[model samples]
Target: MPTLILIAGPNGAGKTTFASEILTTDLKGVRFINADEIARGLSPFDPASVAFKAGRILLRETAELIEAGTSFALESTISGRGHASTLRKAKAAGYRIVIHFLWLSSPQESIARVRSRVKKGGHFVPSEDIRRRYPRLLHNLVHHYLPLADLWFFWDAQGSPPVGLANSMTHAISDVDRFIHDR
Candidate 1:
């Protein structure tokens, strides 16, 4: 079965890094997509700004990839009602999607990491900006209207996902495959 894995969290939660690790370490025959990359390269925006158009394109591309028989692993900071709508569309399209809500217990380490990345001219937005936007972002993540995922995994400040998280994630995808194949 074609599967959609959404890695989501706040600005500095290592979602992108974890997504890369999943693509490189956890599975074979997986295609990786990063929203920030698509946002920066494919969208119409000033070099310094993120484009909403690109964000929408990212979701569209994800669904299209899932429909095309490729497993998609998406890394995004998708905390909003709009994000739920987008993921729901994927579900409505007959795709099996797993949402991994990567999280840090506190933003302290996360904010520091974001600051360091920005000082190094990283793709992530600045830490100060993240700090200012965090309350709203947290609200969006916790309360936004989206379907709960078939499975969820949490990451810590040390960026350590549970030891069995990868195995469980793969199992979920495999279960979806068995279902599709049996049909």
Candidate 2:
């Protein structure tokens, strides 16, 4: 069966970096549907300017991949309800849904990382947007994603080399709730 992997977290929580590493390793050749990469490829101008257009194209491409029964991975903030339905469709189409979540301690960290990435010439997300998305990401993760997923992996993204928190396959952790809620 094909797998639909969601590398999700708050904005700037290192989803793209983790996705790159995993793609090079075990998930070689899986089509990665990243909006930022698409944005960069879309224009010679600033990627941030065409971000919304890239997002729309990304959504279309993702749907096409799903409809074609292709195994793929995508990065998301998981801050809204849209992905819940996407996961449902993928599941019904015989895809094994997998979630790999990267967690930061707070929105401040998200803001900091985004600022740093912007300085390094990455696309910029407004600080207000980061703040708004942080709690929503965790809330949606708990309520919308975990139950639907076939497997999951959670990571602590604070360190240079991220540490594993837990995964549904073998390393489930009890404090996952406390860890998320307390932050």
Candidate 3:
């Protein structure tokens, strides 16, 4: 059985940075999938026009890869309605799911990060849109996505991982390994 690790959070919560660190330093040999990478090169970088399409493709590819027994790490904001269905498909495909939510210090911090990213010529989402969406993203994470995980952890991007999440990357990989062998 393969595993699907979701590293999710609001914009600029360091989802991409953290996922890259995990893949490069902590969890070697795990393939990485990110919808933002798929959405790259779209003219004008309008997430509203391209995000859902990329997300659908991401989930489809994820299910296919999991069914073929490929373990992978995925990064996304995952605030859309399709998130639950995507996770369900992965679960039904026999993938153990591990979700990590990266919480920022505050909405202001989140907005600041988004502004910085836009200034740096990264994918551009308006700061006001990110501001408006932050709370809802938190709502989805807490009420919808968190409960679906076989193992979950939350990290404050401004600081270290929370108490129960100490050494989280190693623990997450170990938990996935345990699940795969136990089945």
Candidate 4:
């Protein structure tokens, strides 16, 4: 069976870079998907938006890709109560594989890193309004529920990327290889 790996972390957790590294370094020929990318094209949902309709579409498409026996990685943020269905669908997908959840532990450090990345012209949340709203957002995501990841990769951009994430990615790739060979 092909593997389905979910790479999750807070904002600015280096999840995108980590996913890139995993695809190139460890799991070659695997398809990688990011939820943020999908969400970007989508119309913004209102607080009372009854349209879970698009969500089902997204989940079904993702499931079909997984069922096609293609190795894939999904990167997304699991913000509070809103993302429960998305998580449930991915969890229900028929892929017995490890979930390498790259959890960046420090919100303050992550915020700084995000600001720096935005300044450097990297893809990041817009700094204009986000900078003002970050405190509440961080408090909710970091202090509230749904912040935990299955496998933790504590990334601090203050220093060089840790070898630990590389090792973890290697282990995940090994697991995928085992799944392929076991068949």
lDDT of 1 by residue, 73-113 (tens): 77666645665665566666666677665655445666877
Q: Candidate 4 clashing pairs?
A: none
Better of 2 and 4 by lDDT: 2
Per-residue lDDT of candidate 3, residues 85-130 (tens digit): 7777788887788887787655687788878877998766677777
- Tell me each candidate's TM-score: 0.70, 0.93, 0.78, 0.57
Clash totals, every prediction: 0, 0, 0, 0
Model number with the top TM-score:
2
Point out where model 4 deviates above 4 Å.
Answer: 39-60, 81-93, 126-158, 163-183
Output the lDDT of residue 108, model 1: 67
* Arranged by TM-score, best first: 2, 3, 1, 4
Task: Report the error of model 2 at residue 98, Å.
Answer: 0.7
lDDT of model number 3: 0.72
The lDDT of model 2 is 0.88
- How far residue 70's Cα lies from its native spot in candidate 4, in Å, is 2.9
Q: Per-residue alpha-carbon lDDT of model 2 for 13-81, expressed as tens digits?
A: 889999999999999999999888898998857888888999899889988989999999999998987
Model 1: lDDT to the true structure: 0.61
CA lDDT of each candidate? Answer: 0.61, 0.88, 0.72, 0.52
